[model samples]
Target: MPAQSWKLISHFWGLKAPHFESQFVIVASSFSSFLYLGACYGYFAKRERNKIGKIQS
Candidate 1:
């Protein structure tokens, strides 16, 4: 939403400019999904480790 960000995105994409609303939504959704996936992975990995530890014990 900042002037510098718009310039960077336009330069990177080789476009005049990106639609602010659409880009914001896309970025927000992508970030949220990444966080969700990380959380899920961490939860499963911890559970698996605990299970293995129990088996070893």
Candidate 2:
């Protein structure tokens, strides 16, 4: 995932050297998107597991 994002970021840099701010924004946004997804998955999984344990008990 990191490699893929780096590839995208590098590609943006290579193609748009003149638009430095835009490239940074793209990279930051892409990275944050991944981080948010990971956090969401973790929260959901933990909540589901807790529910299952309570039901089993």
Candidate 3:
């Protein structure tokens, strides 16, 4: 194996390894936040249904 090939392999693995953890955490948090907001909006809208404006047919 050439020196360049070894360096390329190491750098590729290094870049990918940390991203797995960070990406999972970021994505999970964002999805949870979105779900929380959606639930809150759904609950509020359900309770305030009469107060909200009606749509025309």
Candidate 4:
């Protein structure tokens, strides 16, 4: 997953400079993935909390 995203990001920004682009892609891809994963986790976490609260009430 990470590797594929890295490749995708690199291929995107890497058009100008392949060497420098690798590092940028690494950071960008990891950050983007983390952000998305965090968002999904947060959404599900809230849903779970609501469900539990309703059940308990």
TM-score of each: 0.64, 0.55, 0.55, 0.70
lDDT of each: 0.69, 0.79, 0.64, 0.80
What's model 4's TM-score?
Answer: 0.70
lDDT of 1: 0.69
lDDT of 2 by residue, 1-57 (tens): 456776677677758776776677667777787898889999999999999999999
Q: Candidate 3 residues 1-57, lDDT tens each?
A: 344554565566557768676566555555666788889999998867755544321
lDDT of each residue in 1-57, candidate 4, tens digit only: 566857776776767667776677768788888898899999999999999999999
Model 1 ranges off by over 4 Å: 1-18
Error of 1 at 38 (Å): 0.8
Q: Is candidate 1 or candidate 4 better by TM-score?
A: 4
Q: Rank the candidates by lDDT, best first.
A: 4, 2, 1, 3
Which candidate, 3 or 4, would have the higher TM-score against the true structure?
A: 4
Steric clashes per prediction: 0, 0, 0, 0
Residue 3, model 1, lDDT? 45
